[model samples]
Target chain A: MLLDDAVLRAIMRGLHITGSFVLFGNCVLQGWLLPAPVKPWVQARLRVISQGSFAVLFIAGICWFVLQTVDMSGAQDAGDIWQALPVVAGSTRFGGLLIGRLVGFTLAALALWLGWRRGAAVLAGAALAAEGWLGHGGAMPGPVGTLLLGSAVLHLLSGGVWLGSLPGLWVGLRGLDMAQAAVLARRFSPLGVVCVIGLLLSASVQYLILIGSPAALLNSGYGQLALLKMSLLLGLLALAAVNRYHLAPRLPMGDELARRLLLRSVVAEMALGLLAVLAAGQLLQLAPPAMAAMLGQSGG
Target chain B: MKLVNLIALALLLGISPAFAHAFLAKSDPPVGSVVHGAPKMLVLSFTEDLEVPFCRVAVSDSMGMNDAAGKPQAVPGHPNELMVPLNIQMPGKVSVIWHALSVDTHKTQGNFSFTVTP
Candidate 1:
């Protein structure tokens, strides 16, 4: 069954990652692109992506929480809720991450509420940044976690702007005036550059977290999947480069071929993003590189 | 929406107490039961499936004596229940304690006492 218990867990992980990507992507678009002229259309699209993903993420998150609680070991039952609360609050790094994630989620929800007002997009972006921080970034400890958290915030903000522009590009290609499309392209390109930089930075931090030693890249499944994700991201970057350097500048010519090329490249990038999301889901189940080594040490 | 949020908050608060893993529900010898003759075996029942490898059941006499037949062995096909055979029939109060590290990494312990009379 596609929805079997194990599959459900995987699916929950996938939904969480995908939702974060979409939310972050949209926030980037709203914050970076969406020049005054195209703000309305961009805002509408952002609303759809953000709210829709949030609903799915909320439901999947609830399901995951239920499963975890129900399957907790009997030892957890010894304490009352008041007692358990402190234990859960104090137990593992995972617990702290979970609490942080909840706080981030609440912030995101508040940002969504504020989006109907002026300058609310910035607030929404901040909330999305926080979301990324708490989700996987907070899974580490001390300085490493803080670095991950900051990089993730920047990564999410930039990703939001970059990925959020896809639909806009699609719409622009369909029937929008050439001059207006060119204008939007000009506004988006620089932001896309900045977002790419942030993505690369956060991605490097995540890789460091996952691949402790160069040897682990070959030794562990987590490292292998991480390598695969890195390859896909590189491919995406190459496509973005083509779009930025080759295709974007030719928009004034109203060339259908260039538009199609951009569209195809964006589609490919989106596919690669999906693969990255799946890899992330798999990675969640695997121990971090340092932890894996520690386990090996204990066993040996 | 406000009401829905309130309901959700209530549910979250209410359900926090319900999180529990499989626990020892009952024991065959029964806690503090006094009986004549040594028990043949000790059987433990739990609330959910257990990873059997980590489970152990022990029988100890009044002087802190271990009366294990050999070693704790799995009751084939019943992962949740662990059994250990008794070697000697003694007429004394005995304590049975179960210890296990569950699959979820939670450590579990449950104990009961019974007495053998002459």
Candidate 2:
């Protein structure tokens, strides 16, 4: 059988995205949100998570590259991928961009090792932004291409700030006094709002550039997957609203019940965000409806 | 923000959605067309930028003999166009098969034929 499998590629892409979320979230939590002088135990655990996420990104990224090589070269088997690797890596724009992203990831690791939390976050964000070049946004031509790609980068960075930070919040809330927890939650709320606005604006731009018509939005597989992702985003936003408006306000009043509920809500938001990422992975594989319609005309 | 507003205005004004995936847009010989004489080259234009090294365009005569002169190459100024030199001297029907991998890693392929009259 051919080595080019869409399902496997999508799964690998999802894993890569998940890794980006975690690493980026970790950076934001460390540098921007969490108060300095964290408990040693908390710092240790966060460090472990950060390291683990890097490993996932590295492994999944390599696998994605291999799968892309197989798909691009029309390889028939394992051996063919080996022969095609150099040509794919050397001759293609995708290869060049992948190399640049790897370099960015490497810089992120070095920054973290040097205890430069802000630098690490910037590097991680840059790496995630480079992913825009590997998707539909990059394929667009001319000035509109720049617009689409910029929107994609903004969407990803906002997603990393919002969805990726959930774990940090989950971890930081543990064993904290109600007052401290409330303080932390309040600090995170404004960031969430900024991210939500960014996500909305960028998503709107992408929708206009990618789907355009209502018919295509409802009828095409890409559009349907996009809708599913939007649904998950809505779920996440609802859960975030509850945490920020209802539960967080009660935390400073020593409402233990509200604290527990907020934690659960964070968990729910993380789950929905993960599903959204997976949907995004699948969406990348399918052509947008407008392009699909053009393909249909040419019998592609 | 200004850029976004402009793009939104353009889209609202009915600009075509940006394209992805390398779908065959047109070809030099033209799919299923009859030409008076053999063309020196085949030019296949796609809707997106192609990864030239990974792309394949094969042209064969009715007897199943390869008629492509050498390896297919990218047209110098066209990122989406692939050019294959033709070696057909006497042609009844020439078959063309192609597989293209776009820069975004979307794959597409198709086949067509054209008749050449003596």
Candidate 3:
């Protein structure tokens, strides 16, 4: 039997959150070829994780797209979805962009297998960025649309570079040399700063366009969820700060305790970042104040 | 490459013709206007084509009277323009509430009131 509508929606939401983490996790691994190939065993295990995440991301993405077709077609039953799918994919902007994501990600996955690390990273990042186009920003008109989509896309990719890279940082820190770990930490700090700046600017533009008034942050479901996401992001940033100023300096001095502490903070940061992403998934489902009559609003 | 073709097509289609959720751009009788007589129909222009089945428009007067609005229709050759026939005789302040579902499945709703001095 087919799943209930609620069940399918829940599955789609879950897929979005999980797929983002995993797909970006795979992307994160490519920056420096973590668990380097010189150690064949570690590299092999990392590849397996990469492969599994890619598979999950692909499957979940397909299911999510199919659900959207059913939604747009207003299909009452599974059988009708077959007829609706072609029209949706051919005609709608959402469908076309989604197809583009599918293709980009597929190529990214293929490139990863072919050991084209740099190319694969770029493809995956672009795919991740493209998802922002399916959100509220991409639906706007004229130069406003261009501005919003560009900011939102950059916001997403910058987020990926920051949060998506955390899991890999944890892995990279494992059984790690003190000097090398310190160097890695130092190297990422500048990139993280740039991403933080990018995220802040883009998020402001998005809030202006989507939420309209700052008052909506307290009043609407969409605003409330965004509030929660921002709270979680701030929590992550706090943890990151602790790791950056307090612990990282100690690592260069061959302090084992500092290394462990940094790892713990990184883990906490990653966990909070994941929660932020989950909140984002929920926000995407809710209707922004800019639309809707404050009741029965729909947009995905 | 297929990916390139698909991305190019998506960019061209999205950037040129479509944007986001269908927000009410303008409406018949204009919002909160004092008109001389009762208008026979309500016209709504949105930012995007609507999914007419789920989209709805209604006009109700202050004196607990509801006006008849025929099935909402897309204007001839105008996918973005929606019109609903309205029947109103005795009118005071006519309240209009519209809920629109864009063809992309985004839904938006709002309500406004207009005075009909008759």
Task: DockQ for every model, please.
Answer: 0.02, 0.50, 0.11
**lDDT by candidate, in order shown:** 0.58, 0.84, 0.70
Q: Which ranges in model 1 have alpha carbons more than 4 Å from their true place?
A: A1-7, A36-47, A70-120, A131-140, A172-175, A296-300, B1-118
Tell me the lDDT of candidate 3.
0.70
| 1 versus 3: better TM-score goes to | 3
User: Which pairs, if any, clash in model 2?
Assistant: none
Where is model 2 more than 4 Å wrong at Cα? A1-4, A175-179, A293-300, B29-37, B62-64, B91-93, B113-118
Ranking by lDDT: 2, 3, 1
Candidates 2 and 3, the one with greater TM-score: 2
Best by TM-score: 2
Residue by residue across A82-127, what tens digits does model 1's lDDT show?
Answer: 3434444454332344455545555665565575322345544554
Better model by lDDT: candidate 1 vs candidate 3:
3
lDDT of 2 by residue, A247-280 (tens): 9899888998888888888888888998998888
Residue A5's lDDT within candidate 3 is 55
For candidate 3, the TM-score is: 0.73
- Write model 1 residue lDDT over B1-118, tens digit each, in one string: 3323433443455421110233566666666677677778877765334445446677788888788786666677765566778854568888777775333333456667777888
Task: Give me the displacement of residue A74 in model 2, in angstroms.
Answer: 2.8
Q: What is the number of residue pairs that collide in model 3?
A: 4
